[model samples]
Target: MSVILHLFIAILSLIVLLLFDYVRKIQFYKHAAKIPGPKALPIVGNALRFIGKDSSAAHDILLDIAERYASPCRLWLGNKLFVGIYEPEQLKTLLTSPKSMEKASLCSLLRPWLGNSLLIAPVPIWRAHRKLIQPAFNPQTLRTFVHIFDKHSKSLVQKMEEELEGGEFQVGSYMISYSLNVALESTMGISETSDSKMYTRYTECVNRTMELIMVRGLRLWLHPDIIFNLTKMSKEFYKCITWMHTTAHSAYDTVAVSLQYIMLMLASYPDVQEKLYQELKHIYGKVIPENLSVATEDLKKMKYTERVIQESMRLFPTVPFLTRKVVQDLEIGGYTLPQGSTAFISVIKVHRDEKYWPDPLKFDPDRFLPEEVAKRNPNCYMPFSIGPRNCIGSTYAMMEMKTVVAKILLKYVLKKEKIQPILTIKQRVEIVAHPVEPITIEIVKRLPNTFNT
Candidate 1:
């Protein structure tokens, strides 16, 4: 009697487990039924095909689909469904409906690296931080940072002067060093000499964390362990995570320094270098502080300088893509996206989209002139994004960029050297975009009266 009873119980257990598995599969298939996608394998689904790439294959695949479908389209990976919406109108719909279209869980991957910082915050925290940090970047406050911006920019020119003293020019490395030094000063409010060891570690942590985010995001398509074990990511991944936390903690103590460093690198352009100096002289006269920050009111007055800075941001946005998920069955551009679908609004593609910008490849700052800007679609150009969730640092970043540019232009003659076949700038994907190749240029000191704005 005991043996018979045990056999019955075992059969019942197997039946229960199989039923549960079947139920889960049905639920997933039901949810994903309407979405269209490439064929997925039984267990791995489309995970394997998506994981093999050097760059952002997921985004690239979506782009290809959008082109092929000619409107909003759907794709699937295993039981997961995705809706690819290309038009800005559709993007607006997704962003405005935050409760229904929440951020993807993939963003959770960034949390381990960037913390709950404004760059990746969601909903309430994102909104609150945006408000708190917005005032800090206001036009008035930006004026105070000009002096520091100019100083570091000039220092960058000095470094270039040393590098190209008698040889052919390369602006890539100089731009990188300048960018690093400027970020250090502006973000931390420290002098360039504050701490080299800390800065090196900070740079390393940032680079590694960015690489990890990109790699991990790609790995999501695969069954987690197969890739994790194959790559031996267990130990080193934890170390990178710990290092990221350390950097974020230290960042608080160094905000002003980093801001200054970033400003200096931005202002090193040849086209408007001299004019920037005159503006600096006009504002601060001969007397200037070692470290400076401006009030909100003064930043508004520098319109021309602001325009130039705005142009630079358009060319190089910090964040390349904006991702969101749908919570309900919805129709976008004639296609229906059921609840729990992932979406990405490609900011980079939009910025470079041919239909919107005339000669999008050219570098023309005047494209942002007041009259010209009036003709533009507000949604078409969002270097810092738009709506309630727009970048909080928009004003602050512009001010810093302008101030540094103006200051350096005033002191040096930045010359883009003869066209060389090898000169190039590659974008490094991270929480923010970084220049993979250094920018090199020649810097000759300008006389006091050489150029005037």
Candidate 2:
């Protein structure tokens, strides 16, 4: 009798609390009603839509919703309102807005692992940290990181030799490993060790925690701290972030994922690969690629290679979306994003949109050339995001990617005999987009005399 009474009391209290919440948010609900969205249900809203899906499927569903409606469309993840911003102009406005600095509620999922880091820090904190961190990614500082980038590239080449004779292997592991090491060495000043134990732990923890974060974000019921604390994923998440690499994980992880995609794209397009190689040969004639000393000047001269990197980012942007909570009423297209709603700026939408990119699905490095780029809207390309809160390390990331690719392509010819087309490659997006399957390719060793010194 006593247990039954206590249970009844708990249930009654929950109902009362929910009713109170509903009564207080009458305006949010009213605003959401006017906006168009996927079919939403009473009380639960559209939260049920994601019940059985994983992150990859969740991403697809989100895209479908974005496509079905025009820009600044509506979505209800439970009681919360999300306005999907698909148009480039709208994204540019929201991304650049001073008032739209607040991160969306879903960012709370990353708070524990990231711990008030710049990525999720309050606007004030982000501003302060950005000031301090901005210098590290400047061209001058990033230029200094070239040797470390080249050293790691050489190490990656040697590590990949085992795959030379073997069948197609998932090259992501090797590539990500190299990227993390560069991220750590260049950004964190954590010197590389022969064993790579720390690198493995860092990589695993990042992937695990990010995967869980996306899962929890879509499953609105798991939003509550009290309930989420009980799940196994929550425990694993804490263990991953707390185990090692306390902060700077997001920085390094983003760097790594972008590099992975670029490498895969280069392998997929042999014609582009050869053109890039020719450019490298033009600059460094008759030199040994395995031990080629990469200079900042050399990197600057590789314009075609830079174009390849840019095109790769367009096809599969590493950070697919950037989210912000509307502070004041944000106007996008004809719709108004209620002050409290989320601005889901979909990078994928603009990137893949045929309006901005004719035959957008095709991989063409020439699309980035100065003459061609002049013809398009400036807002159409933003792999590193835009505005005041853009990535601080964009320059650094480019320098490192260019260095690594320069070295690798100098030493090996990347190829895949039976490979899927670039656009058709499957992906799962966590903090960054990851190909569901491994990015694998064979590397044919280039002779020492191919490039003249």
Candidate 3:
């Protein structure tokens, strides 16, 4: 009876201490509490609402909340507060701010997979690495990748020809393979013949790793390394990390998903594809059988083709969201975002905002024409993000995208698979925005006479 009484008293004391700590932390976010947002529940706060949902669903919920409160809204995940910014003005202030250089704490989930690479590195380390790597993406260096892009793209076309038997097939897998090939060759000089089996294993591992990370992120109980490692999923996760490190670092999902969107958009709109093909034909002046290589000079002249790619990205930005942790207290839109606040920039919402994009859902490539682009806010469309810490490989990625797309367009006329409604592909956010369903398309062999090589 005496031991039981003592144990009860100890438990009561611990509960009291925990409550005091919770209140102290809540006071720390008093400034954020004044900001507009949904009313959070006590203790668990808003986290309980997102406990079982996938990242994509959770992302959609946040987007909806943003719409309800508009930009500069606060979200509470348990006791932690996140500010969601969608307005161009707020985005400009947040993105350009030097103090907001470090990635948010949530990005730590990516550490297991990406390691301490450029994508998730903190500000100081990122700066040093960015300076060292910037030269590799210069115009001269990127020009060398044009040939590699062309080769792999042609290889992609051949693979598609052999694989797609007129019926609808998912282009996502093939695009991933093509992008992986380009990334390996350009970054590590790994040719296709170097280790085909290893490449296959690496791709499989990457897919598994991403799926595991996304699922784990939503489960609060799995946040701790010890608990996560004990699970069966961690076994595969570590295995993937080993394979990834053995080869070069992993490629971003944006590269593959961007290609998927471009293909889907072109297929959905044949008129746009025809115009793009005509521009390509005018540049190449009839596709040569033996010489499918596109020069950098010729690729530069593809204004309309570039516009199509840009518009595709605008409609479906591969990276739908970007986040940053505030290193210093900042003020925006008559509200103070205290230091340690996480800022969530909704790229999807910003790109689709009717204020910046008239008839925002329409796929109009002409929106990218210099005159139209000049009329809009510079911060409105940022598929690759903006400011100093933006993607280092943006220029290289664009050139590669254009090269591969132009090559594919030169050989095939892409048409929608007709089994699904046009533009009905559902999107899911798993690190990068990807279609929840298979983006199926039918490819007709065009320029058969030029294919005798």
State each model's CA lDDT, in order.
Answer: 0.57, 0.81, 0.81
Worst 10 residues of 2 by lDDT: 444-453
lDDT of 1 by residue, 270-308 (tens): 344444455555665544332333433445666656655
What TM-score should be assigned to candidate 2?
Answer: 0.92
Candidate 2 lDDT tens digits, 348-394 = 88899999999988999999999999999988899988888787777
RMSD, one per candidate, in order? 6.8, 2.9, 3.1
Colliding pairs, model 2 = 285-451, 285-452, 285-453, 286-451, 286-452, 286-453
Q: Candidate 3: misplaced stretches above 4 Å?
A: 1-19, 22-27, 163-165, 194-200, 419-423, 448-453
Off by over 4 Å in 1: 1-49, 56-71, 75-78, 128-161, 164-194, 221-231, 247-304, 418-426, 451-453
> Which is the better candidate, 1 or 3, if ranked by TM-score?
3
Evaluate model 1: give its lDDT: 0.57
Per-residue error for 41 in candidate 1, Å, reads 6.8
Give all TM-scores, in the order shown: 0.73, 0.92, 0.92
Instruction: Please give the lDDT score for candidate 3.
Output: 0.81
What is the lDDT, from 0 to 100, of the residue 185 in candidate 1?
65
Clashes of each: 51, 6, 0
lDDT of 3 by residue, 1-453 (tens): 699999999989977976887687664477787789888886556787788787667767877887799778887775567898888878889988988878888788889767677889988888898889888888888888888888888888787886444666788878888888888888788786535576577767776777777787667678888999899988878888887887778574678889998998888888898888888777887556337787899889999998998998987888888889998888888787878888988998888888998988888999999999999999998998887878888888888889888888887778774634424556777777777876888887786534311
